[model samples]
Target: MLLICHAAYARDTSSDSILAGGTLKPTDAFDMGAGHVDPLRALDPGLVYDMGARDYVVFLCSLGYTQAQIKSMLLPSPGVDTSCGGDESDLDLNYPAITVSDLSGSTTIRRTLRNVGRIKNAVYFASVRSPQGVHAVVWPRLLLFSRRKERITYYVTMIPLKRSQGRYDFGEVVWCDGHHRVRTPLIVHVNTTMDGGSSSGSLGGLQVA
Candidate 1:
């Protein structure tokens, strides 16, 4: 039996549906293509985003979880200490997706990628497509992975060029290493208001297909 644990969240369900062009329901979750399992291909996935226990603790801390609350969630393990001082930025969680909510203006998000390709040194190029009325910029357009599990960080900035109140825009940022295409979906919600008050905006999440 193959067991795959999927994280459950309100956004994951809805976002997966939007990406798949399916109904907005929990049952549509597998339509995103991440749930599909192939034993043969799994044997040699070129690259993967590796997350460790510390990464999760840091992610929880960034979500404003208290030390006590975070500690309570941890299972007993040897040589593992719960620390809450990791990067508090939501975008730095080492996740496969990128999501940003509550955007009033221009904002930048950071992401790190790990290289697990069979080749020792592989170069990946970055390409991005911005949604309507939005300008997206990526720094360090070229990434070179020298060793296995080598990680690199890149930043994406989304700037609102025009007012599109309560609009959901979809874009994509992809990394091509000739053979494998590592793609990350970029979702931006425009919440421009005349008085600059809080307004409804859509959230962004990561997707790999």
Candidate 2:
């Protein structure tokens, strides 16, 4: 049985007659759960984002972990390089979420997705539900997969649209292949007073599809 470990990969495979509370953390959860989980949908999430044990090491290095500290954590693991020589940024981690705590200007984040559907030849197009005070766009929105587990990388460019200070806003980047709509939340915490450079022009007319 195929399993998806991340909640960001969860899809809503329910009909209109059924009420399905999704996996997104809600603002008001006093009467509801944090999120809902569908076992059937988890089994067949059309696209998935994955992270390996070694990738965490790179993430640690990006977070300013020292060489000794990183090596200490990876002890007894054979054939692993302990060098913090990678130029990979923390924002470039292969996680399915896009979050920017402070937007001082236009920022572009890259995400890679693997098509894990039963249908080998699947073409997915992207669409954006941009956040209230932010503009998000994905480049090369069309993803084509000819084989299972085929990886495709896309870039998301986000800029401040309203820049409401300390506002927590939510949006979604959705990919659909007619059968499944794979979506990821675009969370942004706006800091308007931080001299965010070039908050102008929608960062090149944000468009994904």
Q: What stretches of model 1 exceed 4 Å from their correct place?
A: 1-44, 193-209
lDDT of 2 at 101: 79
Task: Give the per-residue lDDT of model 2 (tens digit) for 117-204.
Answer: 7987889999998888777778878998986538888888877765666667777788889987777777777776323334543324
Poorest stretch of ten by lDDT in candidate 1: 1-10
Candidate 2 local accuracy as lDDT?
0.68
| Residue 49, model 1, lDDT | 63
Residue-wise C-alpha lDDT for candidate 1, range 67-92, written one tens digit per residue? 78888898976555576775587666
Question: Each prediction's TM-score against the native?
Answer: 0.70, 0.76
Clashing pairs for model 2 are none
